[model samples]
Target: MQPGIIRLSGLFFLLIGSALVLSSFGRVDNAEKDFSPEQPCEWVFKISDKSLALFQDKLLDLAFETASSIPMNPHIKDRSRAQETVVLACLHLDCPKRALRYMDQIVDWRRGSCYADLAFYFARRDCIDDARRCIQIASQISESAEDWRRDRIRVKIAQTYVWLGQNQQVDEFEAGVVDSELGKVARVKAMRSDADAFHEQMQVLETRMESGNFDIMNNTLQAYTELFHRFYSDVQKRSLVEEKIKTAWNGMPISTRIERLTDLAEFALEHSDSDKALALVNDAQSLIDGRQWPLEHFIPMMGKLAALRFRTGDRQKARSEADAARVLFHAQKDTIVNIWKAGTLRPLAQAYQTMEDPDAALSLYKQALAAGIENPNSRPRAEDLTATCLSMALYAVEPDDDLWGQAHRIYQGLDHPW
Candidate 1:
């Protein structure tokens, strides 16, 4: 998966759902005293509206230019998915025309899904004609797709229709689905339609897994995570979601649970629930202290956990965690494969920045940029560099003159799609 896209996906969901819920509490500006730049909405809100628009334009331009550079090949699909992420982001930012330029650059089922998402975007704004037009185009693309790809696209179309409250259209696409992957697609369609049914099925699945039935599918757990957050405000629903997630992770490796807990902590922080975020971070820390993991997993998790701890107001421990991660990074720097060096360093840099160590952060950022350039695979190399640039831009990390020149030189030389 593209790290660049992973970072952007959270923003896409926040723009569509969380922003509205948060507005009822008050604009992000009102909560400035309570939050730091660690919050995504707050960070973007800190920027002037004019600057935000200019940043959006620059991001889309980068995405489009990257997409244009990709050569048509079997592997091009993976590269183009990063551009697809930017298209969704552009639509959320009210840059629909720019989004369309990158839409056609995506391949197969993904392109159809992008149009379906665009249709949803338009539908929410009451642009019914444009919504329907995009849905028709998405449906046509789905029809031309073969086998499992067709069902995948249809699932996106059906979900979009659900959002549009077009039940007839939803059912039409649902009926056309052919079972694949042991009817997982059918289960996804059913689960999406009924929350109560999803809850009941999750209970049953959790029971079976605890009793030594085979592991739950990763996608099933992912679907649960996505759906459960919508009901996070409901006390009983929140309990159920927490139980399911913990149970699902029970038998996985400790590192996996640590990672998930850290992610849950970050998600809680996004919603401004500091108490819950701190609890999740404590749980992850317990796991971290219980065993020794390979440096690969341990270092990144420490970097992330450190930033989260700082956000939760545990400044002393956060500083210690960051220092420990920095130490481990130096010790293991030569042993880490070139492709993953930037991935590891980026988070460490963020942790330092969060801790108000700009000099250290700046040094690490430069090291990450250099490491990103070491990857032989052009596409992934570009992705690593793009992810670093995105983290700097979105989090308000200011580069000094020397680092700015270095980044500009690297970006100008990038010719492959990220």
Candidate 2:
């Protein structure tokens, strides 16, 4: 791994960084938003990075016991885990729609982790109402809105610049192409060599960010985020990004390292350097874990890991990572600031399709599509995703199921969904 590898979130719900959650953000339900758990909640990653996997695994085991109505073995821990066992048991026993009822079991829903987990569960199923409720409950326990807004604005802007650099649009240098189309091809190379030529303009706009031209800042940010992601993922094909450009990137404030490290991670993958991808991802997770950022921030990274694991033939690990990606994508279903590249979901979706879970693959494809729409500059990309998803649906879905009709509808109704 290179210097300044990003540290990802320790929690694996899973994509916070790069399945950069294939992310969705929406309001939580209010009716069942408040509840009290047997004890105050604690984040699982804070306890063990493996805790989430264990929770799900143990839940399945506990389900068998619950089905037979057997007592769970005694194990010392927090009441939250036991409560989660029961709640998941409830959902397992045909009460998926009654997720809210289980929410009532938690004491002070905002102060506990169960509500959040449940919210994530509902989100995976696109149970927006229940997910929203869980989100509301979790929000109640977080930093005050004023403080969060302030920090988010600061973080969002840094993220914007980092993304711009990664998505820089420039063709690779080719002497022959330049000779053939002097002005056009050579100009493209010039742009690549002077990638930061926009720095002066960016500085001007960045200044206005504090002055409250948020729309301009956000719109500009969206445009640049897409560009930077593109540039970083494809950079390995070239010899060097300008040295000054590299210096500025490496010299960026630590606060902005999340996006930079993430792009580098993708860049590593694009170069077929799985070892580097793994190293960079682990480093980024360390950073993410240290920051205690929201779970959404972890998604893309986990998704990246999922892709890596799948490539390395660790099917179980890949499945676990992909599952985490799916959960986070649904749970953190809001937030326009994505640190991961677009198309990050394709591999995971393809993995699922390979595993014969067309439904899961289709969902991920749609999630990626939704994420792609956040940037107006990535419309072509959005179309790429659409085309990919449509093709997947057409080929992967079994004709016997009603999925073909649904796929046909999607192909007709939507612009693009990969």
Candidate 3:
């Protein structure tokens, strides 16, 4: 761990300095538009939503209990996967002890990766001792991993060190990736390094994206996001990057296009660029409106669109969209599998919550939990139950005792949650 590791939110400010602080004008969400010196991290980390904090302690308790209740799968691979899922959920809930507990059960190289993530999470929270312990464990595990896996784990560790602002340790960890082009690009972003060098990296990434490789496509989008944030004030550069992103997205499937555009739209919202966010949202909306996708795909996407719409100050359209989605959901509910039903319901509930309709939100959340009960398959049921629990924990709505009890029984009942 770094000797002078500061808080994550403070480090973010230091990274950008005063010159990059965004104006709060045209903010659309319910959060106070102006950035406070006390909460600078909120602007960059969506998980820092105040609503989540309100329920954080309860969420962590439920998360730990739920994780403990899940039965271990007989197969090592399956067991590791299940543990990884719970570890990730625990991390998201800011329950590092529980995360580490589950992560220790993981039996694959991924356990090393998870440790790196835990280290990053700890670093963000300024938990230096815990972060150092996880980093040591991760390094030890990486030493015995296959060459390729070791390299990947090294990159993850390097990234964590970068987050801790430990330049010396970052250089040491990143040394293993000196020959890797992708690693180079990743390091640049992790270190908040030279902007001009990223231009060449962006070109390489864009060219790879043209090949339509899914991983490269995602990397390209992430690169665009990094560049967009880095050069947000440079209108000409931002426009050029946006144009390239749009061009790249043109060849993707309609669903993929909608998802990617909305992700960019959400990023725009984070930066208080409501106009850009709306434009991107509109682009996604047009695609959703014009396309004829399967109802299963359509409903969930619609739910997401409704939430984004509400966030962008189009509450009326958002409500209309949610209503339309609910009707479609009912029309096809019988045919939809329990997994998809839960998926669809959760987002719809989120939309309603954002719109300040607590009753509607609570009802939808209950429905989401019930949908998992309808599943005959044990694994999907367990997955759905855990996810619903996590969602309920994060949302403003408090689940009734009955709902939590039902989820607890389902988690305990599963013999193979993998």
Model 3 spans with C-alpha error above 4 angstroms: 1-59, 64-71, 75-79, 93-98, 105-107, 122-133, 144-152, 161-195, 210-212, 415-418
lDDT of each: 0.60, 0.39, 0.61
**TM-score of every model versus the real structure:** 0.71, 0.31, 0.75
Candidate 1 lDDT tens digits, 312-402:
8888999998998888889878887776677777778878888899899889888888887786555655555555655554444677778
Q: RMSD for each model, in Å, please?
A: 11.7, 21.1, 12.1
Model 3 lDDT per residue over 1-418, tens place:
1221212212221111111111222322222111112321111222231234545456545544554443332333333444455566555545556556556655567688778877777776677776777788788777766666677667778777777778788778877452332333352352353567657756765776776566557555656655665666678877877787778866667766676677667667777888888888889888878666766677767777787788888889889989888888888899875556776677677778777887888788778778766757565565565556555654546766776676667766766423
lDDT of 2 by residue, 1-418 (tens): 1111011111111221132222222333332233454553333221111122332333333322221221111111222223334444334332433333444544322223445445544543445565555555554543232333222222222222232232332122111221112222211122233345545433443443343333333333322332343344445412233222233333343434444445455555556777756665566556656554444335544555565556544568678867977766566555435424334555556557655577887676565555645554322232333333322432243222343343334323333231
TM-score of 2: 0.31
Estimate candidate 1's alpha-carbon lDDT, on a 0 to 1 scale: 0.60
Give the C-alpha miss distance for residue 367 in model 2, angstroms: 8.5
After the best TM-score superposition of candidate 2, give how far the Cα of residue 148 lies from its true spot, in angstroms.
Answer: 33
CA error at residue 200 for candidate 2, angstroms: 21
Q: By lDDT, highest first, what's the ranking?
A: 3, 1, 2
lDDT of 3: 0.61
lDDT, residue 306, model 3:
84
| TM-score-sorted candidate list, best first | 3, 1, 2
